[model samples]
Target: MVIAAFENEKNLPLNELMIPLDEDGIERSVPALNEKWKDSRIFTRYTSFPFRANTTLVEEGAALEQWFSETGWFVKDMEWLLGLEHYRFWSTLVYNRGAIESVVSFTQSAVPYYLAGAARSSPSVFPLYSAAHRATLQVICRMITQRESDRCWIGKEFLGELLYKHYLVSIPLLFDLLPVYGRDNKQVLTLMVQTIFKLQPKYGQDLKVGLKFLQSTFKTIQQQIVTDRLDGNIASLTRLNDLAIYTLDCSTVLALLVECYPDCRSICTELAMEQSITNFYDNTIVVLYKNIHAMDNESTYLTYLNTARMELLSAFRGIVNFQLETVLDNPQRSLIPADKFLCTLTECLSDPVFVKDYQRHYPVEQDLDVLRQACRSVDTFKMDFVQNAYCLEDGANGLSNGYVEPLPEDDESFGEAAGGVAEDELAEAGPSTASGPVLTPEQQIEANVQKVLDVLPHLGDGYVRKILSRYDDVEQAIAAVLEGNLPPDLANADPTEPYIPADKLDTLFVETGIERLNIYDGDEFDVLVHDQIKGVMKKGKGMPGQPKNLKEMLDDKSHVREMKGRYQEYTNVCDEYDDEYDDSFDAMADSESKTVRLTAAMRNALVDELEDDDEDDAEVEEDVGQSGGKKTLDFCENPEVVRQRYEESRRSKFQARQGGFVPPGGGSGKDVVGKAKGQGQDKSVLLNRKQKGEHKSSRANHNRKQGATFKRNKGMIPS
Candidate 1:
């Protein structure tokens, strides 16, 4: 009947199918369907609806393919059948047994279809407009409840995919279904958490969707934890681990959102704080603290600080109770009372360094009270321990001397009287007992102040004494020392010397590696400065001011001498270069010498090449120019040969000119040589005079020529 109804309604439009069934149709169909299919063998025996048909029915396995093909629920263009009045009515009929199973099987099989359809469907229409969506939710709830069993309606992987699909389609429906399915069931919650974990990396890139899901899921788990339904066994452990993994995965996304969208950080921090507080154990709290502290934002820091202070306070209370019980129950063990231990703990908590971070976020007044109360209680208990110990010792000594008497068991008054006598004797003894004298609170405070003074050079003895006299509280004394507020001593032991701030003295005496001659005597400012200057002077000479022995000083002097020798060697190298330059000039000035004098051009070229290549060629060239002068002068000495070459060059130039050119001086080679010799001028003087006349002629005819040919053709003339 169900199959026939589905087949008949397969062609109906989704909108028409969505109309509610009338009372008559429900009355006529409800009973028939309930009687035929409610407890029928087909429904009772099979996990999924039997979609395949044959004249002789053969039992088919509950595969999802059978539902789509035979039922036509998910086939193309036939999905509207799920919205038919008869189909929804049929879903109502099987609401108890196979409804959830069939829905889960079908949704798991047709996840891609629903995901695609959800994209086009309106939010109001998805997961509820169709009987298939109702069935999908039923199936999800059943799967969550039945998650622990080996025989599941759908596999975990497929179930996870279906859940993610539903989340994409309608987040409202998914959230609604999560509590119904995962609320009380650890296995279901674990699966939900783990599925979210898997999908977060893939689809959770959407901050809104991802953060909402994470926060919702975390709240769900937290609710479970608060109601005490989550077992503390291994199964719950697995569930928590899954939750932790999901939180960690989402933390990175939340952090980015916190930075880019700072307003959202408060929401994220609150969510994290709630989750951490719900799972508030040692390891989880530690992880939360680390993550919160690592965030550079102010909100997270303040949240973490407040949370840590509360957690620490709670833990300390528990410790106090436990230790108190132990001390009360076992008085013979000589254990300190809880208050003493709490005093030590409070000392750590009240430290300015430790409390400096959280003071802005958490109130310190209560903590200061806790510290003071614990200390006062411990002081009272210390007197008790002392009195008890003294009484025990006296009794032991009396027994050893055979002078003690045991009180009768019925005489409670005798025990009270003996305790009173012990207390009185302790009071009369004035804190001095056989063991030792117990220091008063003031003395203890003074000792702690002295310890701070010993380490800090900025804390002078006069300042420390003044602080001690003003503030009886150890914390206040320490604070005064740190703040540098102690009154100055009016009477300087050395009246002749000027007053110096302790910080300046510290820098001058301590940091400068200056050691005092006698620390017992007060620090002498003049002596400290003199010693520091002497140490610096000695260091410059490589003589250690605080050498270990005489031999060390001698070795230092030798080292200094060796360093001076190396310095002298470095200076000699610079002098050698200067001397080379002077020697070159001296060689040039000698008239009879054959050394070559390099012009400024040659010298600059040599220097540039030396700088460019850093080669020995420049040095070799210098040596040859300076020392091998005879060879250079030998090359320059042959004037007749030079004159002959010049005449030949002049004749060649006359031939090459387009207009025939005459040789200058208009004479044979001997006439030129005789004229050059008759002038009694050196080669340099003759060359200069000839160059000057050529320059004049070139300048005079420059405009007539196509270009300045004389200047272009001028080669290296003799200097």
Candidate 2:
């Protein structure tokens, strides 16, 4: 039926779309799709709706929106809607679920274009009509609850994408819708709270910022409540009543109030009259418990609630028990059995029925031990005694009535005195013990006040400050307000109103020795940072002006010294680089001596190697000639003699090149005179031979003289 309705609205063929069915739909026009959808059992386990199908559906809506606008069907509706308040659609959608989604999707989709149009306007005007917008909100809300049974999740991006584009202008407008639509729409309230809870899992601090914004809107809602009541607007009142009921979702609104602002109780109390405020809190708790019960199958939600409940109970117990403890401490004061209240709860908590039910419903074990211990303590207190205490029937003494033993009557008053009193009877009837002392109300109050002082710091800074300031002027204000000791004008004065006039504060600044805090024109106060630092300083121990320990002082000195050393090292590196630049300048001026010597040495080595190669080639030529002319001579007859002749020939040829004079074999310059001078002394050749020939020729001559003593040298002419 739903699929058919959707198809009929879109004018689409039913054959293309697969529709899931229950056993009931038999005579439907596209029965095969329904049959297939059902037989497939796909509905039971959908992670996300198929994207192709979703896109097709969205395209159908786009076509529908376009067709309606072009054909002037909704043009009239649009014109009409444009003129009504933003909430007009919200109201309309509350009655009709089919139209709810279309309107929400349309508004969310159209917001950007509207904003764009607004921006282009001479003086920007929002395109949204408030009434129609609100009506659309109601429609969306109706859809959320109606569709919840199907578990048809609306992806968060559907809202996020719209908000992302138009947040600057539309966020405040979105906030306005909450006040208008949230009051009666429980489903919408739950959806929003759940969404916030999802976000809070990751970005709690950001969620707090969002919560603060939402909380401020509650103020406007309070004003609207008053306005509607005074104007006798029944429609508005009914809407507001619906909104208020919906606002009870896990007391999310109340939780936000407490979280965003500390004085939320007083604000909410004032908004809800004195009598109804308590009912509001009770209703909120009912909503919380209902949600808790709803998640019985899952342990997570139960655990969260159980943990939270335990924390609250523990804190309350701590406050009450401490009061009892203090009352008992005073010798004059009697203890008020405040512990009885929790004792009963503790006993109930330990009962298998309560524990099993609590565990089944809400299964968080955050501080179960503490909760169990509390229960155990209460269990030790007799149930009957607890009931009597709750009834306030138990007096200072354990006796039923507040009674004391009558003093013993004197024997002289009686005409006949007792002959004998039995010793055993006297002993048995002697003053039996009475119960412990009971505290007076005044002492109880004092003990409670002391407990409150101890609990103050835990409540947060804003709460502490507000509480401290509330009764600062009690002496003057109380007598005037309560006792009628002062004028009626003073009696009705607002406590929050400043005691000193603003003008007087300025005058007093000059009159007293105290100087008003001077803030420079350019300076901005960092109150948050200042508060953080003040908190740190406040927690510090010892005399305020006292010096640190010797170790701390020495460590501080070391730290300073370490930093100075690092800085000096950095400066030294910088100075070294500067010195390097100066050295480079001096190096440029005295560069020629080393460059000239190095060039000459390189040239000489190249020339000498070339000359040595030539001498070796010449010797090879001479040996070849001698070998050709050999007449069956044995070259190895005297090996050392041949070696000495070879050495002499090499020395004689090498000496004639290079500019230096060389001896042939035995005398100075003898080798040059005998075999090398003039015949090979070309100046260019001498330059080429200098490095290779000089050392080889001198060493060769020294060897040839030694060879002559061993054998007659054939290659060397006597020199």
Highest TM-score: give the candidate number.
1
C-alpha positional error of residue 597 in candidate 2 after TM-score superposition, expressed in Å: 44
Candidate topping lDDT: 1
lDDT of 2 by residue, 1-719 (tens): 34332322333222232233334665444422232322111111001111121112122345444433432432334344334322232223333333333343344333221122222231211222233344455433433321222222233443333223323113233333333344344456546545443422333343345545544543444455456547975433234333433343223333432332332233332232212222322223223433333333232333333333332222223323343443345423322233433442344432222222233333323223333333343343444333332222212211111111222233222212444544454455553311212348654434333333232212232332333334444244333334556444433544334222245336545655444455521123324223333322333565554445777655565568779977887665433357787898888877744643457888899899999999888877787788886346565679898799987776655565533455434443322223265565655545445644666566657576677855555655564
Task: List where candidate 2 sits over 4 angstroms from the true fold.
Answer: 1-134, 145-179, 191-477, 481-719
lDDT of each: 0.40, 0.37
lDDT of 1 by residue, 379-484 (tens): 5454443333222221111001111122112223343554533545555666543223345876555565555443332345555555566776657767655675
